[model samples]
Target chain A: MTGLLVGLGRASLSVFERLGRGHLFLLRILLGLAALVRRPRLLVVQVWSVGVQSLLIIVVAGTFVGMVLALQGYNTLITFGAEQSLGVVVAKSLLRELGPVIAALLFAGRAGSALTAEIGFMKATEQLSAMEMMAVDPVRRIVVPRFVAGIISMPLLAAIFTAVGVLGGHFCGVGLLGVDEGAFWSQMQAKVTLLDDVVNGVMIKSLAFGFVVSWIAVFEGYDAVPTSEGVSAATTRTVVHSSLAILALDFILTGLMFN
Target chain B: MKDPRLMEISVGAFVAIGLAALLLLALKVANLAQFSPPPGYEVKAYFDNIGGLQVRSPVKMGGVLVGRITNIGFDSKRFQAVVTLRISQIYNSIPADTAANIYTAGLLGEQYVGLEAGGDDTSLVAGDEITITQSAVVLEKIIQEFLYSKTTKSASPGS
Candidate 1:
């Protein structure tokens, strides 16, 4: 019993310590934002790596999700003779929930893991230490750009995901299933609003997810033990932790925005 | 990573595509244009009960949407629901004697204001009051009245 209590206390303390360190790391990156703006090339390169490279996966995943939603929604809606509302179901689901959440989950697995691996490798090779020796802040030179790139790329990727998802829903709903085209478009337009559904739901949610995911990735990388095994562990942790963070933040944001 | 120019081009394309997707969502899906009230005129109508009528509900003339409900308020003295409709600028030829009625779209659909035009030469301008109006039909009330009438008739004959 005494051993179990001691173990619990130690675990809790470590968790709190890591949380404090993560916040401090985020603050340091934010403090370097002004310097990062002057050299936009760094951001552009990171965005290319993060956003452009991830486009194909986002689009493909979005299409499949949307198509599946239409198929499932149709089967259910047709029972009540309200299949015309399939568009509303599909669009609202994508814009309000699935688009941001799923996209963020994907981003965590893809870009978040890659960022952790890259930064971990840099630390393992003493690249960050070399930058520190050269009178450059490693946080500013290395971390801030990748963090800012994640923030910028996430919303754009989510928006693209939603758009492609809507098209996929349309193809399954109207083209394949022979639902009325006018009813599909009109119902969606009537229900979904730019301010409430798009801006607040999709954009804001993605932005928050982006911030959380990037912060976790960079912090895990920076805090890792400088060894090959440690780098692998950090990469795995970045994906796991960020994915959990995205889901928790999504619930909170949804309640605040939708309610 | 090697080719900077190619990287820059791809990044720009990605950003452009993202913006384009947002535009499509705003226009094609959300229909942003519907939110912005067109240059138009406002008219008021009073109803006994608006039922499920809500602001931004489409205002139709002859089964065609020409405007939207701008506001809904209550007239305490008259004990009636006052609804304001904003007709689009292009549809300026609505007659002064138009009768506004609250109507449900389908069995379980949203309600809207439908205008039935009368043969009047004069056109309605801003803030014009439409005197002739029909309140929304309430299903519960109709059922209650029907049951009451049937019971009364049966009891009266027996008495």
Candidate 2:
């Protein structure tokens, strides 16, 4: 009984310690972000690496998701003789839920893991130590640019995902299924609104998710042990933790914004 | 130098496309063209049960959307739902005595307010109440009625 109690206490203490460290890490990343205003070149390069590189996957996946949505929604809506609302279902599904959430998940997997691996590699190779010896704050120099790029790129990526998704839905619903093209577009237009669905749901969710994803990526990379296996393990943890965080954050943000 | 220039150009185009995508989304979502519609006037309608009618549901006149429902409230005294609609000034020609109905678009779809023109020449201005209204048809209530009548008819076949 005593041993069990001692073990439980140790677990709780370690959990609290980890939480405290995570909080401090976030604070430093925020400070680093504030310092990024003077480092526009760094920001651009990170955006190129993270955002530009992730574009094709975001677009292709977005289109396929939208196409599937159109096909499935048409089948379901036809049951009640309400096939005319395929556009509304497709648009709302993408904009309110799928667009931001899926984009963030993909970003977490693709860009987030990449950021972790690159920074972890730097740490493993003693580059981070070399930077520290040169009086450079690695957080400010390396982590901040990636974080800022993520925050800006997420919403853009989500918007692109949704737009392409809508077009894909249109293609399936109108082009293949012979759903009236005008009705499909007009019904979608008449229902979805910028202020309610797009700005709050898509834009805000992406921003929050972007911050969380990059923060996890950077923190995992920064805290990694300086060994080859350790760096690889950190990379894996970055992807796993970032993806879970994205999904959990998506749920929380959706409830907060729409509810 | 040339590689960096090409990268920058690609980055620029990427950002531009994303921005363009946002623009298209906003346009489609708002149902606005390049230009926005002018500010509109307001009107009110009452219903026994608004059912699933929501704020921002389109207000249509003769199959054309002229406005949107701005607010939904309860008239406690009359035990009815009060819906306020903001009609665009371009569609200010709705007769003063016109009636409104809460209509679902395509079966099982979103609900909107459909206005039926009365013979009166004087058009409704801001804050006029559309007294005559048909509330939303709740399917459960409809099914209950259908089942009840069927059972009653079967019980008394000669009648």
Top candidate by lDDT: 1
Clashes of each: 0, 0
lDDT of 1 by residue, B1-159 (tens): 698999999999999999999999999899998778888999999999999999999999999999999999999999999999999999998899999999999888899999999999999999899999999999999999999999999999789
Identify the CAPRI category of the predicted complex in candidate 2.
medium
Worst 10-residue stretch by lDDT in candidate 2 chain B? Answer: B29-38
Q: Mind giving the per-residue lDDT tens digits that candidate 2 earns over B9-92?
A: 777887898898888888875465623545888888879999899877888988888888889999899988999998898887
Which pairs clash in the backbone of model 2? none
Per-candidate TM equals 0.96, 0.87
Off by over 4 Å in 1: B150-159
What shift in Å separates residue A89 of candidate 1 from its native position after superposition?
A: 1.3
Scored against the native two-chain complex, candidate 1 gets a DockQ of 0.87
